[model samples]
Target: MTDPHLDLAARAGVADERALLSAFADNYRAIFRAKVAGLSEADARRSPVRTGTSIGGLLKHLRWMEQAWFQRVLADEPNLPDRPAGEFFPTNEDTVESLLAEYDAQCEISRRIAAAHELSDTGVHHNLGEVTLRWIYVHVIEETARHAGQADIIREQLDGVTGPEI
Candidate 1:
């Protein structure tokens, strides 16, 4: 059967670091989403490992991570509300569809916000003080890539699926 989540967006030309961020981040995001395609709510909530990171929780966490870097830090919007996450399971409102939709929406906002800043543009981070837009992009790419691998493993635990369709 065709997996809709694996249908990744086409990469734009990587003429600069910004384009590179979009391509790599978007690729992993798509692959990560595909990792949990058609998972039951219970299965999505399962945390087989001691770290207590479930596939559904990873989706929620990734969305939150994107907002933390791109929207709150890079865009310098400190007033954005924070979301509390569970150790492994998502909150009651976090269904598979809702999480995916929110993540995609955040991606759109990230694209728009990222284009407005220069690589050297600076923002105040809560923990790290001042940081550059370049730093945020690099941080996000690494964070997303790590979670993508985690999602791949968790998805395999949920079902027998291994290796991303993307």
Candidate 2:
């Protein structure tokens, strides 16, 4: 049987920096999404941790992050919706399926935006000033991986599921 987990080493072996970073970013995205798979709506919205970081909330936050970096920052689209007041907590209308679908759509938009620019191309960040596509890729990878690990722990707490597999 084929091994299901992403092979980071294989991804790292790619010579192109863009490809390598995109691979890692996409891998962590998949891992985070898998962590929330098969969870009931109640479980997905449960805040087991003190900080109240639910799986659904993570999905929503990450979806916004993708739009912030790729659409607003890179694509120069200034009219994106503001983040909800709860930030990491999903609203009552946000089901797990809807959150996941929105996340997937945002990720696709991110990929398209990234593909249009070279790694060295720069975008003006709201706080950081000018930033390169390379920096964005690395930042997103770190952010996604960090949250993915958090999701892993939360999923394990919820149903004893561990790792990135669905």
Residue 17, model 2: lDDT of 83
Where's the lowest-lDDT run of ten residues in candidate 1?
Answer: 3-12
Task: List candidate 1 segments past 4 Å from native.
Answer: 1-14, 85-88
Error of 2 at 118 (Å): 0.5
Please give the lDDT score for candidate 2: 0.85
TM-score of each: 0.85, 0.92
Q: Which candidate wins on TM-score?
A: 2
After superposition on all C-alphas, the RMSD of every candidate to the true structure, in Å, is 2.9, 2.3
Please name the candidate that would achieve the greatest lDDT relative to the true structure. Answer: 2
Q: Could you give candidate 1's per-residue lDDT for residues 21-54 as a string of tens digits?
A: 6666667777776777788888888988898888
Clashing pairs in 2: none
lDDT of 2 by residue, 1-166 (tens): 3334366536578457888888788878888887877899999898789989888888899999999898888788877898777869888889999999999999999999999999998888889999988999999998998889888888889999886442
